[model samples]
Target: MVFGYFSNKRREKMLQQLSDSRPNLTRAEYVNRLVKKGFNKHQAEIVHDVIREFIQMDNFSIYPEDDIHKIYAVEDLDDVELIDVICKKLNLREVVQEDIDELDKTLKIFNAEYILTLTNHISV
Candidate 1:
């Protein structure tokens, strides 16, 4: 069978690992942990960048009003704007069409419904 980008078991394992390490960890720290766990430097960096962008785009914040505001703000992002934001948040160099495609694909794999809600301005 042709599995998705990440197999289900691997996905679950990664989620568990992230959950275990999330507390008291910064983005860089978490990425470092992933690197130590056998993720390559590039993979770890992409994972870090994507996770941080996901956190920023999440509808839940410290305050309910902030959550609502964030949802609306994120809903306004076009694909290019979204990519730009993710790239800026990640401090990535040499972002290209392939990078954006990879980001979009990864996000879709993370949560298909989320792409519809957050990126209504672009066709995914």
Candidate 2:
């Protein structure tokens, strides 16, 4: 009797886990829900598909950094660091950052570095 009781309890617990893991909703039941809410099957399916696609989030696993955390600062930083920070702000798009960084790096090397050196060398 004890064994049977433990077995039943284990089964109930397992079933509860499964139910929590995935909401068990059949397509027909979903359709019925839509119909009651004044949607035909075709319309409901279209709307459902769009919602599902949005929720499903099928995309490239490699997100460009920005989607995770945003970075905002007005200062000077190296190219790679700037790219990573900008990617964090721009939803991880590296291409734009790469182009901008190239221009920034070149400009710094050609003129800004000289200007900074001169400014520092001056005495008050």
Candidate 3:
């Protein structure tokens, strides 16, 4: 069966890896940590919700420092969909290469916090 954009085997492997590496935190604690890191509550929530929906994972399991590349394969159709969903959810302008370059990092190294920061500056 298909799971999100992943095949069943790929999805299961991803979920298993995530479960093994997941941080020990409640949802409230996770969000609070994001806010403590300078992300506003709404931004944190959006990141949490979007990631949870995107990967079909427990949102609290995701950490700001978790590398997006490690979470899933990059430059795939799913990657594009993730960016689109985040932009739409945050009402942000379309993401461009300049914006990614402004972060001084490539998509290969992006994490949840980087996403929040990127979108924060891009919001309409």
lDDT tens string, model 2, 2-82? 998997577556545644665555446555665664544654444334333422323211111111111111134433443
Name the better of 1 and 3 by lDDT: 3
Model 3 residue 50 lDDT?
A: 78
Ranking by TM-score: 3, 1, 2
Better of 2 and 3 by lDDT: 3
Off by more than 4 A, model 1: 1-22, 57-124
Regions of candidate 3 where Cα sits further than 4 Å from its true position: 1-18, 21-23, 58-60, 74-77, 105-108
**lDDT tens digits, residues 2-90, model 3?**
56646757856865777677656666776898899888888788777777677665533666667766664444566657777888877
Pairs clashing within candidate 1: none
What's model 1's lDDT at 108? 40
Residue 72 Cα positional deviation in candidate 1, in Å, after optimal superposition: 16
Quote the lDDT for 42 in model 3: 83
TM-score of each: 0.28, 0.28, 0.72
Reference-based lDDT, each prediction: 0.41, 0.37, 0.71
RMSD of each: 14.2, 22.1, 3.9
lDDT by residue for model 1 (1-124), tens:
5585456457456445544553545556655655565544554455445534654533221111122213223343343454455445445443456544655654543222232222322322
